[model samples]
Target: MQIILGRLDTHLGRPRQAQQRLRAAYDGGQPPAEYWAAVGARLGIAVDDPLAERLTAADIAGWLHPDPAALDLLDELRSAPVQLALLSNAPAVFGRAAERQDWTRGFQHLLFSGDVQLIKPDPRIYRLLLDRIGARAAECLFFDDRPDNVRAAQECGMRAELWRGAPAARSGLRERGAITP
Candidate 1:
C-alpha cells in the first residue's frame, strides 16, 4: 500500500516568490499564518480557519494549474490494487482543488494536516497518517519530494522514497517489498 503524494511529489516552482512575500510579512511581524492566508487569497486559493493552520510547501503555489497528464495517470492509478491516499498539509484549499478536478475517487483518504493541525517532519503527522491509512508504519510505503519528510517517515518505520516519478516510486516499492517489481 502507498501513501501517494501529489504536490510534494514535484516542485511547482513557487517558493522564492512566496518566501519573498512571506519574508516581508514576517519581518513586519505579521503572523506567518496570516501572511500566508493573504498570499493564498491573492492566488485565488480559498482558505478556512482549520486549513490556515496546516500549510505546507504546496500552500504557496498559486500557479497550480491542473496537469491533464497527471490527472490521466491518477485515473489509471485508481484502477490498480494499490491503495492510494492524498496526504498534504493544504487546508480547505485542497478540497477546492479536488472539487475542481472532480477526482476525489483517486484517493481513499484526503489526509489534510491543516484540518488536523499537524504538518510533516512532525512525528504526530506520521502517526495520523498511520491511523488514517489503517496500517502500521511497516505496511506503508511513503512517497514525497522532501528528504526531511522522507527521513521522518523512515524514522517512524514507514518505507519512504523521495519521488522522482513512476519509475522511482515503483522501484522504491519493490526494493522495500511494499510491491512486487
Candidate 2:
C-alpha cells in the first residue's frame, strides 16, 4: 500500500501534505475517482490524468491480495464454529474486492468503513458493527493491529485485544475458549 502511495506521491510532486490528505480521504470513504480528484486538487495535478486512474487501480489491486496463512486461520476458526465477522477501515473498492474472494464467505458479516462512511477509532463505527451483528458490545471479541483501534473497541465494551500475529491470536482465542486447543 505504501509503495503505491509512494508512487502517487512521486507522481504528484512528492508533497508531504499529500500523504495525510490521501490517507484521510481514502479512510473517510472517498471512491476512486473522487479520491483521486481530491488528491489532484490538493497536489495541483489534473484530475483527469490517466496516471491517477492507474494508481487507483493498482491500490485496489494491492488490497485484494490477502495472506494465504491468514485465510487458513480463518478457515480453522470457521470450522471451530466461531462466528466470524470482518470490520475493516478500508475503501469501497476493498469491500468490492473482498466480496469476490471465496474466503470471504466464511465471515457472517463484512463491514467496511468506506461502505458505511465510518472509520475505526470512531465509536459510532463500533456501534454500527454491534448493530449489524445483532450483538451487545460485551458479547464480541475484537482484534486490531492498531492500539488506538483496539482501545476504541474496549471503550465500546468489547473484549478487545491488540493483534500481534496469527500465532498469538490463535493462542489468545484458545485461552479465551473461543476455539478448542
For candidate 1, the per-residue lDDT at 21 reads: 45
lDDT of 2 at 10: 79
lDDT of 2: 0.81
Least lDDT summed over 10 consecutive residues: which range in candidate 1? 1-10
Top of the candidates by TM-score: 2
Q: Candidate 1, which segments miss by more than 4 Å at Cα?
A: 1-33, 36-69, 171-181
lDDT of model 1 at residue 117?
A: 62
- Could you tell me the lDDT of residue 130 within candidate 2? 92
Q: Per-residue error at 52 for model 1, in Å?
A: 12
Over 1-181, each residue of candidate 1 has an lDDT whose tens digit, in order, gives: 0111233222235556664545344333455467556755555565555555555334434525545655665666666677877776555444456545566567887776555666777789899878888889987777877898899999999888887776655555556554543
**Residue pairs with clashing backbones, model 1:** 54-114
* Per-model lDDT: 0.62, 0.81
User: Can you write out model 2's per-residue Cα lDDT over 1-181, one digit (the tens) per residue?
Assistant: 3444664657666556656657666876886777877766665665665665776777777777667777777878998866788999888877888888898899999999888888999999999999999999998999999999999999999999998877888888899888887
